[model samples]
Target: MTHATGYAALSAESPMAPFTFERRALRADDVRLDIRYCGVCHFDLHQARDDWHNSVCPCVPGHEIIGTVTEVGPDVTRFQIGDLAAIGCMVDSCMACPECVRGPEQYCVKRSTPTYNGKDRMDGSPTYGGYSDHIVAREQFVLKLPEGLDPERAAPLLCAGITTWSPLRHWKVGPGSRVAVAGLGGLGHMGVKLAVGLGAEVTVVTTSPAKSADALALGAH
Candidate 1:
């Protein structure tokens, strides 16, 4: 067993404490990462407190991971040592399934393996997450960190950026199109940024007028 250290809540309602556990050794398709800075998203709270009823005890919580690739499995052709990479909210999935075959494991009809607090399909052991010093995951789940972007700021884009891609594209909005992004939370902020990036005139709808300036400051037009 590979040893690892992370912060974890011993039980629901308890503060996260130091934790040590075993990580599975590298497999033919695995990539090992030396985790850099991980963003603390608000969902951390929900998962820590069992708000969604998906909490796994000794829960080590985090998914937005930006790191340097330290090792790659023999069959991993996409990345090599010293390359910057990212692990999002997913780690593994049954590649034989239709969704996996299409290259969108997030929509895997059999359900993709989530980053943390998930079960490993092969070993039947619990999978932990990115709130740790390192992670070893199958190469398919790793996203290449763009050289142009700052990894710290780019971390949230893994989960946040992908969620808002649909609504904007679904409406076929483009230059001169008026778009409305509701709310100002993490996901909402990503929505505003994306809409503006796509050349849409974006107005963020918020019950709190306090967020109006923030929305505008974040590139919402």
Candidate 2:
């Protein structure tokens, strides 16, 4: 086991405070990462506060994670030590399920293992998250940080970015496609950028007329 330190909410009413925990020893397909940046998603706040009524205490909540590959297990082949990498909301899943094989592991029939506030598939140990010094995850759930993207700015892409990008890509949004992003929030802004980037005719639908300039600046028509 590897010792790790991070901030955690000890209870629903508690503020995040320094906490220490153990990361499981490397499994053959695992890659260990030294965390660099972790995006603060609203889900983290909700989980920390037990707003969903399902949070575990000492919840260390963060899922948009960017890190450096510090070590790779014997069977790991996709990453090398010192590579920039990332982990999103999921850490593992039963890959034999039809959903997993078809490509949406989030719908894994056995239920995908979340990055935190979840039970490890192997040991049933409560999984801690990326607001930590280091983390161990299966290589299948890790992504290679693209070479030119800035890690700090790219962190949100793991969650907010992908959340919007997936559907845009699924619908084959492209030149001549009309895309309407609903707001200028985290996910909305990303949707606009992605839709515009994909050559779509993007529109930002907002209740605030003052945001018109901001929306236009973001490439929304």
Candidate 3:
């Protein structure tokens, strides 16, 4: 186990504060990252408050994470020291399950282990999120942060960006496709940008007339 420091919600009702805990030592396929930027999601608030009722305290809530690789296990092949890496909402899953084999492990048949508020399948250890100074995760769950994409701005790509992009990619959205996004918020805005990038004609139907200009600026009609 490795000692780590971070902020966590000691109780459902209390605000997050400094916390120290042990993270499992690197497995053959694991990479340890020194966290740099953590993006907050509304989901973080809900989990921090135990709104879904399954939160394990001391809860550290952050999934949209960007960091620099600090260490890699002997079998780690995808990343090396100093490379920018990102961790998303999932940390691990039963790779043998049908859902994982077919892709989209997020919908793993045996329940995908979320980045935080999840239990490690192997030892039942509570899995913590990225609201910390460092995190150790299997290399498969860590994404390579492309060079020149500002780490801070790119953090949300792990969640918001992927949330929108996955569906579009799955549906084979491309030139001549018609896409309509219902809101102009985080996920919606990213949907508009990606849809348009795929050469789709995008229409953003929003309740807020105020967001119309913002939508157009994001490349939606």
Among these predicted structures, which one has the highest lDDT? 2
lDDT of each: 0.88, 0.96, 0.92
* Stretches of model 1 off by over 4 angstroms after superposition: none
| Candidate 2 TM-score over all chains jointly | 0.98
For residues 45-113, write the lDDT of model 2, one tens digit per residue: 999999999999999999999999999999999999999999999999999999999989999999999
For all predictions, the C-alpha RMSD in Å is 1.3, 0.9, 1.4
Candidate 2 wrong stretches, greater than 4 Å: none
Ranking by lDDT: 2, 3, 1
User: lDDT tens digits, residues 113-175, model 3?
Assistant: 899999988889999888898998888899999889999899889999999998999999999
Model 3 TM-score is 0.94
* Candidate 3 Cα errors over 4 Å, as ranges: none
Worst 10 residues of 2 by lDDT: 180-189
Each candidate structure's count of clashing pairs: 0, 0, 0
